[model samples]
Target chain A: MQRLVVLPTSRTGWALTIAFVAVVVAGIWPVIDLVNRAVLFLGLPLLVVWSYVLIFACFAVMLIANRVIEWQEGEDD
Target chain B: MTSPWPLLITLTYVAIAMVIGLRARGGRRMNSLEEWGVAGRSMGPVTLYLLIAAGSVSAYTFMGAPGWAYAKGVAVFYVAVYLAYLALVAWYFGPKVWQFGEQFGHVTQASAIADRYQSPALGALAALVMSIGSIAYAVLQTVGSAYILFVMSGGMIPVWLGVPLVLGCIAIYLFVSGQRAIGRTNAFQGVLMLIVAWAVGMWALHNATGGLRFGPLFERLLAEHGEFLTLPGAGGDMTFSFWTTSIIVSMFSFMPPVWTQWMSASSARTIRRSATWLPTYYVVILPMVVVGFIGIFSLPDLARADTVVLEYAMQHLPVVLVGLLGAGTLAASMSSSEPFIHSVALSWSRDVLQPLLGLSDALTGRLARWMIVPLMALVIAPLAIAEPGSLVMILLVGLGFATQVLPAFIGMFFWPRASRLGVMAGIVAGFLVTVAFTTLWPHPLGVHAGFWGLMLNLPVFVAVSLVTAPADSEVVERFFRIAAPRGLTRLGSGGKTVAADTAAHGG
Candidate 1:
């Protein structure tokens, strides 16, 4: 029952899920509706900057996930 | 090629990369298919990162992306966004692939996918679909590289000669050393493109705006052309739904080159480490697209949007820097093209021809090696010469079909309920729907045909699986067991394992 927690077991899984949602949100409805405008930020368009931020966010997440992921050998009979 | 300076840089870049390729030509004799196809699975983290990074960026980034920025404005940011997600995809799936690759001798994506489902026929189908998609990409590379050579040479190098010249060189090196050559050459090209991409972008930005700072530049552009900085861009060419879905579809688009590079890594950790850094690789797209934004203000009347980078660099930078930029574009294009050609040839020989015709291992390897020349000349050369569409458009069309495989790939790792028959039906239906949507009647409410296809694909996949018999329990067990994430452990298949594999192919 304890193992049934909704949280991802590994950092990699969390990054994978979050990055997936981030991409769709940045690229799709509901979320995209907010960012898809004519404003400028940080010397770039607000929308373009949004994409850059997402890329960096994914990068940051994977950096954390990579630290946690490890390889183990299968059992020997 | 009147501009000997750029032509010289291009030539020098070519010579250095050729030397790297020749040096990577594997030892003594051309040996096992593993050595040829996956570099004997001996790539370290740095080598794999460079190879994957180079494989991702192409003439499209140097030329087409800026053109999209120049012509369509903010729409080009789709390129950068999708790539970041691609890195995350690689990190999550790559280790599992590396695990499976070790336990089984799977050298191609189709082989691995087919093995998971315990279906050779499914593998063959995947091989066939991916071959078409990969060849379409190879064609884009051929056309894109030829365009660079032609333009840089000041019309001295014609498209006819340029296509074969670039293709011939790549074919020979790939033939000689296979994936080893690609890894070595990619490392050289990848570093050059990243540095040159930023330099050219900064120069263009500064030249156009009087400074490299983007806030002022965007502010100015907002004053002059407010619409260019927002969705649907300048002329409202790409709408909100189209742009968003394009990013989503392109992000998930299946590429065998990525998997090929992943399988070659020494361990799953090597892949995870490499994937961690891959998002930074999108740095190339940022500057290249900035160059595009610069072109909008500086050289707004260019005949072809695809020539935005070339035209902008010529106007702003010195001859030497322009030449260097030209060299980088060509090097980037050539570096990116070879892997697709190699992957296509691999899937054809290992996954399709071997299984379809029942060819022996030795025979398939020999046949695959010989197949590259005709495959390029007869199939890809015509399209390269035709210059059928913009690099991004042709690339997207290919991606539409490639994205059809996403359900299958996702089901491989996550969904135990996914049956081979169910997945296969979904793929076929999705492929057909995508083709019809892209060709027969496009702009289905401005949602990319691929996204719409996915809409139809998911239900069929789930519905059919609900009714179909599950895969054999033993096969299913092996699939999940091998793919399950685990802590650091000993390598399984090497009999005398010592931390898995890596030292490159001889050199």
Candidate 2:
């Protein structure tokens, strides 16, 4: 997990990019409309709930990427 | 007549911010342009986070988010995803910038590009684009502060007066302390805005619904005003593609202020850690969204959707709380606006003027910076005062143009083959195309203008670069050395398989 810092590296970057594209696709259009058609979860629309989920996923990924940077900085010493 | 309580609270916040600004300077001699412009590159994570978040969030969250929510419904959530992506963009790009700045003494974004591509013209071009965006954004903040003042003062202070008054205060602190004042003040404002945003969001929920939970209330909105809960909301304006593009455009806008903040950090890890904690601040403004939703039912006939947050604050919270929260909201806008104003000043002085005049002296740099602080504020104040109907559109166009610069950074760090000629051509072409898409033809195929511009820009940039000369090998190596992956491979160039890496960094 920590090794993934400096995510601009082609391999890790590709994976993150794919994940983000997937997230973007899932959040927009046809799919979001599909979620909108569903029943509310905890009183919020499924689409809104889904956006939070995707955003959280972004946070989780960023956290790992951050750790990677920190871990590598330590290695530089 | 204006209420004394709200005025008092706002004044207290301002007074505290002023003291913080003064203290931030702390006897440090700002001997060079770098020190004044980037806080001498020594900000910790906490100060950096506050500065970045306060600079970015601004009137957009406390006021505009609720305004969008009140007017358009689910369409407003575009703020959420784009902001998250912006953090991601910052996280990915910021550290590399810090490394370059540390190694190269680069203060302005244009300086980095000029150094990297060995083209002073390219750097000047970047400074030009960023100045336009920063000035427009500062105007938006001015308008936002005017509205907040109008609400807090019970309409005693008008927009024309409000614009100069707020900008005047910002100009003073900024001229005196530069980035240190801005960073320290942001720490106070950031925490205050967060606490207040949540409080107001929850209060709006309770005041409107007779309860704290918004899930049930929102479901009714879905049941009754279903259009509000879906795309092309309320007015049928927000298309799926538009929503996605707005977020994408925002993520890639690459404002100069963010560049200054990123370069100002003490370490790359500070940037990463600050960026990591950034998303949690999302919850801070969730209530503003809820306030907008409340406006959908409670204040149905209000003329301006942007006034929703203020209306809710006045109607729901007590006078004292309104005073306190209003101070926070106004503080948020003011904090964010200062950076925009400051960036414009920095770019105009350090990037544009110095290059044009060929000044290398530290005293000259500081003088140029000081001159622009008041000059830029005065230039933009009237426009904010005029309160043109096209302010939002102008801001959008500015941001669209800002997006044109993204390819340069991408080319510099990731694509070794990206030539200066190609970038300059792409920027010109992209700006022209964005203008066409935004004004002449709004949202081609329901996609936002900025995205349409990029759709054209990226291909042109790549095609031209492939044919033209590449940047100096040594310059490319220096950028890549810092941004390079573990084995000194340039960004997005590690481990073969060019196609995959190319797609990953394309954003």
Candidate 3:
């Protein structure tokens, strides 16, 4: 039986794959260092706010990139 | 001091939903299974957004999130963490799924994967797994709705009656109107539930704490019961690892059924636009979280943390408002249950039945409606017999099905050489690993088993895909021709054939 596959073949795809993996790893790494006390003055609110902004920005960039790629493809057509 | 007005108002809401469903049945132009199951695959952004929000933010969010916050303190904020991640997933995958759905005329996630991988067996397996998980999910909603009714009626309504009643409504609506009814009712329920949630949240917080300020309450909790506020507190409460893992799990869990919804969107642009703004629902949930926080300070000693929101509303809010809150909770459960019922039916009829029986889309859509009765009975009967578990735990278990979809769905977009062999291997491996981790292990390094399973699944997906020979180039090219960036700019040359088939088949 012939196998069927679906996905894009492009640098953008590879980049996204790498970035997603990196974020998953980095986001969870802090859970391992249980006893290490880092004295930071930043409050939970600031951290929460910062994380939201960061995540939103990441997705915004991804959406924009996809849009640009589509636009470029339209131009090529 | 008793009043029947609250019960009257809630009955009115239920009647309105049923009326909407009946009206929607008149507009049925369902010539195909996709049109029946996914609203003819023609939902606009607003409708799609409402459908998604209504389908996702279930009774769990109405009661469970706040209840969790009340019990676990700040750690409950992880719910928001997952909601944000869910939006990201939707934003990334939504348009692509829509494009593929449009091309293949796909109705279910399994059909999409099966088509992409050229494996009917894989599709059957996916449909089976999804059905099992979705039925479990439906039961959870049944339990939630029953619990709300039981509580609201002050135990006048028995669990058996309530469970069947709620499931009956879902079955009737799903049978009568299909996805059109689901979308319309979801839109109405979504608005009512949101308003009720916001009103109850704001009113409860204002009345309990005398203002929106939670600073004093937080400080008090810290002083007296600091353990509840922090992870793995002195009392062996939730740990930081647990909190982090739960966040990750919740974020990723939005993939499975939601992907089906994305595929059902009317257009790629609708999917894109919906993804962009859907996170606002998460933003609206802040008030619910605040209500939970307020509950901690006001009713710190309350038992059964899942009842925190309801208990607070009962104790503090006026009678009419309490009924509204009860209706809102019911709406949350019904909104999710209705769409899920339709999706489950679609999965069975499209992925399992059509392939097995060689039935046309019209036959399948009719079969799907017939399937809803047995499905609802299956879910509600068990819920009535068995006691409900922790809402979060139940939610997580239901969400485990979603994790299984990650490798195949994500690989479709990002990994070009992802073969059917690899996708199948990944799915089987993911399922086994998730089940083993969940059942056999107490805790894998103090993290949820789903996280461990996901960790295992990703590597299996990559390793198998890389080691296996690539799929046929023609198939790959066709997929890209329909789904890639360039594909988005121009309609497929094969569009004529699909349109012809749709017209012939009554899509």
Note the DockQ of each predicted structure: 0.36, 0.30, 0.16
Candidate 3 deviant stretches above 4 angstroms? A1-77, B226-240, B254-256, B388-398, B466-470, B486-507
Q: Looking at model 1, what is the TM-score of chain A?
A: 0.59
> What docking tier does model 3 reach?
incorrect
TM-score of model 3 vs. true structure: 0.85
Provide the lDDT at B298 for model 3.
Answer: 76
Worst lDDT 10-window in candidate 3 chain B: B496-505
Per-prediction share of native contacts kept: 0.55, 0.31, 0.05
Could you give candidate 3's per-residue lDDT for residues B298-321 as a string of tens digits? 777887777888777778889888
Model 1 residue B151 CA deviation in Å: 1.8
TM-score quality measure for candidate 1: 0.90
TM-score of each: 0.90, 0.92, 0.85
Candidate 2 Cα outliers beyond 4 Å, as residue runs: A1-25, A29-31, A69-77, B487-507
Which candidate number would show the highest DockQ if scored against the true structure?
Answer: 1
Residue B131's lDDT in candidate 2: 78
Tens-digit lDDT track of model 2 for B191-228: 88988888877877777778889876887897788888
How high is the DockQ of candidate 1?
Answer: 0.36
Residue B16 of model 2: what lDDT? 89
